[model samples]
Target: MAEAAVTQARVRLADREGFLAWIFLTPTVVYVVALVAIPFGLAIAFAFSDVTAGDPSYDWVGLRNFERVFDDPVFWRSLWNTLIFTGISMFFIVVFGKVLANILVADFRGKWVVRFLVLLSWTTPVALSSVSWLWLLHSIYSPVDWVFRELGFIETNTYWLGRPNLAMASVIAVHVWRLVPLAAVIMMVGLLSIPTDLNEAAKIDGAGYWRRMFEITIPLTFPLIAVSALFGAIFTFTDMAVVYILTRGGPTNSTQVLASWSFLRGIGGGDIGQGAVIALFLFPLLLAAAVLILRAVRRVETI
Candidate 1:
């Protein structure tokens, strides 16, 4: 009888454990289905349809929307701009962020204050930051403009966002400012996680600072850097707020990116299908990048 009772208790406990596991996972499953899966499926469907605002009608267009997207000069231009913006911003973030992380990892006076101020750029709201940048870059009252004129760098006040080249430069600069903090934080974490024994061994082997970094530190910490870069790429690729607030794809649409272009098509122009197609394009590229990075990380882990 006691044996039977113990068996029954074990069964009951197993059942309860199973129930709890499901209960815990239920919210996440529901969230993914509702938010990610459903929206993604709908976007795919919309991309193949001819959907417009207030039309009360949509027809299955097969690959027509995609073909149109390929032929559209504006779409291609936006794609180019997105690549340039993401590439330039990511370069700065990785190069400078790694340096900053190395510096901050060492003990120094007032280092905490400097780190906090550096991170403030990212913690600040994007819209508010963009607005502030706009004011600072304004032609007439801009401190940058005033300083440049005072230093005789330019003979006159310049509208930085009013020209194609300068507009692109300004947008990329702002993106770097906003994104670098997060990258630095990620790098700092990676730097901290590295076992000190490796560094000590390298030092004992007469490896100099640069040699140790290149031969040991960088290779081990590379996975984290790759992950950070992938995330930054996604963020920059899908970002519309900064561009909208700063350039509005203006100065003749030279600074337009995929997200802003999609917004213009869907919301501003009322062409839902094309906009959906544009938005969908970013997903595959980012997904591919993320998958590749994760695979590399996994390989590193296995080694």
Candidate 2:
């Protein structure tokens, strides 16, 4: 009788476990289909159709929207700008992130204060931070300009966003600043995961700081760096709020990225079809980068 009861309980437990698995998975499946899959399907349909924000109606246009996008010089320019923006921002993010991560992992006084300061940029809302940056870089009554003037760095009020190059640089700087903290925290986690014994043994064997960093610390931490970079690239590639808030892709649309340009055309210009096309261009490249990064990370993990 006891054996039979034990068997019955075991069967009940198995049934409960199976039910819970489906319960946990059902919401995620529903969310992806409703939010992600449906929107993606609609965007593809819009890209091929003659859709407009003003009309909310569309007809089959075949390749017409794609042809129009290819014909526009702004599309190409935005593509180039996106590459430059994502590339440069990622470069600075990785470099500075590593430095900050090293500092974070070390034992020090007031480390929590330092960590909080570093994370402030990432924690703040992008729109609010962009506005702050805009104010700092404003032409008149700008603190940055005033400080530079006071320091004799420039004799005149430098229009940070009024010029094309300066505007692009300013946006890149802000993006990098925002990205580095997240990257730093990721790197810090990676640094912490490395076995402390190996580092100590290397030190005992007369490995200097730089030698240990280059030979031991870097190799182990490289996978984390790649992962951080992949996330940074995706965020920078898709983000529009920073550009929109800062310059609205101004100074002749010089800093316009594919994301902002898509918004400009699809919503602002009422050409939803072309905007969808512009937005979709990012999908393949981002997909490729993600796949490659994941593969590399997996390979490192397996080793």
Quick one: best TM-score, which candidate? 2
Model 1 agreement with the true structure over 1-303: per-residue lDDT tens digits: 999999998888778977879989999999999998998898899898988997738799999989988999999999999889988988998888898889889998999999999999999999999999999999688899999889999988789999899999999999988988888899899999999999999899999999999988888899888878887888898899889998999889999999999999988998889899999988977887689879988888898
Per-residue lDDT for 1-303 in model 2, tens only?
Answer: 999999998888778977879989999999999998898888899999987976887799999999999999999999999999988998999999999999998899999999999999999999999999999998897899889889999999899999999999999999999999999999999999999999999999999999999999988999999999999989999999999999999899899999999999999999999999999998987898789888988887898
On the 0 to 100 scale, the lDDT of residue 238 in model 2 is 94
Query: Ten consecutive residues with minimal summed lDDT in candidate 2?
Result: 49-58
Q: For all candidates, what are the clash counts?
A: 0, 0
Residue pairs of candidate 2 with colliding backbone atoms: none
Candidate 1: residue 104 lDDT (0-100): 82
lDDT of model number 2:
0.93
Provide the lDDT at 196 for model 1: 94
Q: Using lDDT, give the best candidate's number.
A: 2
Give the TM-scores of the predictions, in the order they appear. Answer: 0.90, 0.93
Model 2 RMSD vs true structure = 2.5
Each model's lDDT comes to 0.90, 0.93
